[model samples]
Target chain A: MTRDDLDVDPDELYGRLKAYEGRTAASGGTGRDPVNEPMIRHWCEAMGDTNPAYPAVAPPTMLQAWTMGGLAGHPGGSARSEAYDELLALLDDVGCTSVVATDCEQEYPRPLRPGDRVTFDAVIESVSPRKTTRLGTGYFVTTRMNVRAGDGELVGTHRFRILKYAPARPKNAPKPEPAPKPGLTADPARRPRPVINRDNAGFWEGVARHQLLIQRCLDCATPRFPWLPGCGACGSLRWEAFEASGTGTVFSYVVMHHPPFPAFDPPYAVALIELAEGVRMVSGITGVPYDKVRIGMPVELEFLRVDEELELPVFRGAEA
Target chain B: MTARTGDELPPLRIPITRTLIVAGALASRDYQDVHHDAEAAREKGSPDIFMNILTTNGLVGRYITDHFGPRARLRKVAIRLGAPNYPGDEMVLTGQITSVAEGTAEVAVIGKNGIGHHVTGTVTVQLPSDAPGTTDASRTDAPGAIDAPRTDAPRTATTPDTPR
Candidate 1:
């Protein structure tokens, strides 16, 4: 099919978007919360950032975090203009539906202190014509946000860019293929082996024998997976292996499709299974199609012998 | 040793997991479905949910501060994303001090995963005049020093290919 077959008039779309440039994307938008220590603490804990500078003055990089609307969305319903919505809808109408953030540039002029209220304004800086990117063909939309403290002092400026595009069609639909037979010369296309070491060697040994193991703290009896050297609960270095009952529920799952790997096929379900023992482990979910996998699905452990040298612990649902 | 133009920071290998991806997004307060909802991500044409730019920004910030000490102020951070960071993968972050002048150093950083380079950028950090090691020492008694800052000289990874 030619470019015209996609039903997109490149010139007309470009001309339509030109009027949106310099238009206000957001005006007088208030932050969801004032700069405070608790939110800063949460962010630091999650990022493993223990910088002593935090909980004093907020991290300079967190300038935009204050402005985000949570799962409930912005209280005043987005605080963005109708023109911005219309602009995005225009792209969607032309089959450019996928969107990915490509770049961000931020400048922090001054520290954001605790109890500081923030407000911001954003303008649609520019919009590029349809261009093909490694991810797909889409238009690059850039917006500039000016963040100000309650005192009306400009604290930071953020330039955000996103690519709204149609995803590239896969060369071939991904099919679930059986593991390659045992081979020689170190097949690069084979599944990557799990890294085994002194701390976790026992768990792998259990897997080879078709037994799923969870580390148990000898002192506190807390069970943990992705075996750690010490128990997080009791801080004990001594531990014993507790064999799992092999049944669990899918706490969460994802389907892999992009940047395909050599050893594994695409469109496969990788689930975080919560075992009956109350510990979670990351493994492949078998016996069901990728789309069929769901959170809370019941599953049972099974040893998948992918090759002569490798056998992995995988879970299969009841349907399989 | 003071940071020079050619100083190479140590490499950090991070295990990318679903927990980290979700936690990072929540930490950033980004409620975008593609960052956490796999089914929604697939419906939007992605094979899986991926990391958000804000999380990537946080990680990049952590990389710089982890090496340059807490006192090092970040003047600017500009990055461009390439390959997406999906679960069940690993990202290795490496950096080099491309230039150092007037208490500021420009570090060029690259984070690569199994697919390819996930993020490429330059971080402008304001290091003390003497060095990051000495600067971290004087603040050991600061009220919120939580834990001692890492004052060790950057250790270059001899075997970059080894999995963590």
Candidate 2:
């Protein structure tokens, strides 16, 4: 259904939406919690990111957390402007009642320290004209928020965008594609290729020859996978290519499904393999359905000829 | 992770899972049902549970700092989401050092999902005074078979996060 269902004039509606371009979306909101270590720890643990620089300060990404209203949202309606709600209501008055958040951009001027208090004010930055997406036709609503600390320090700026539109009609059933094969071939655009450069050319060469190799720093005796030119632990260019045992366990994994790519199937598991030698590398896994791929599962490396021109190192479930 | 201007940051691959979406949402105190409940997501017109913006923001931050190392400070992280990162999808994050000047470097980043770009933006990082100045000869950081860090060339790939 299009705007025919609603009696609002196109020009009038567009004018009304445009009128809110610079209007305040929300303002004068205080964070429910201060920048603290517990939330930082939980966030890092969930993301599997363990950079030592955190907790002393919050993750740069957590720039929005300090200003969130939580499950119930902002304490009151004091911050939100009536115009923002009116624009949304007008969109809903039409047939576009569905909503999906598209993306967000955050700019941090300074990291938030543990004791800093955060306050913010947000504005309706812009409202896009009617647009069509893979999901459906809708307008993109963007909000710009400025966050500050207790001492009036500008901590960060966050711009968040969302699409409020009616979802597209689902299509009729299409023929099922064949299961992913060892020699699946398609246009090169659809397949991911290894970046071959001088720094790690040897690693790719080893893969072509069916050898899994890791870089070992001769100066520090430390082994690293994914071939770096120098050892980060010790600044050393002296290194040698070490053959890997081709055996490892799935330290963690994710099953991919969308932002669909051509010639590739979704709901497949991509796993991080921690080799028996104690280094980790990312690769694909087979032999089990995506949901069954789990951490601690044993896997062995196998070179798969993905396409005529491409051969990749993949892992196979060692058991089951 | 540390490089001169025009160097490509090592790519980071993160698999978008139901567990990741829910845990990230809850962890960030975003209790929206769409991020954690498949049925709720379906009701919201999504195929399944999808990732929330807060989680995406967190991951992007992690991606930058992980490559630049702990000392690299994020002066600004401006990201725009393109695709909905639902469960069972993988995000390959790739970036390049667009410029470096006055103790700061601007990195242009694009995160593509299986279908296409999920997020695209620039990150301005305040490099530490005593950081390593890695030359182009080194900096291998991909499961990089598919994604060599984008140099001056027009490269469109990233690191691997899974064995498959």
Native contact fraction per model: 0.49, 0.60
Q: Worst lDDT window (10 residues) for model 1 chain B?
A: B155-164
lDDT of candidate 2 at residue A178, scale 0 to 100: 23
On DockQ, the candidate that comes out on top is 2
Please give, for residues B76-100, the per-residue lDDT of candidate 2 as tens digits: 7777766677655677788878888
lDDT tens digits, residues A37-69, model 2? 988899888887787888898898888777766
lDDT of each residue in A1-320, candidate 1, tens digit only: 11222467789889998789999988888888899999899888766677788989887778779888878877868878788889899989987887899888888788898999999999999999778765568889999999999789999899999998876643243522222222223355678878889999999999878899999999998999889999998799989998999999999999875445667655488999999999999999889988789999999999998988999999998763
Where in model 2 is the C-alpha error above 4 Å? A1-8, A76-78, A170-320, B132-164
Off-target runs (Cα >4 Å) in candidate 1 are: A1-5, A170-320, B129-164
Candidate 1 residue A116 C-alpha distance from true site, Å = 1.4
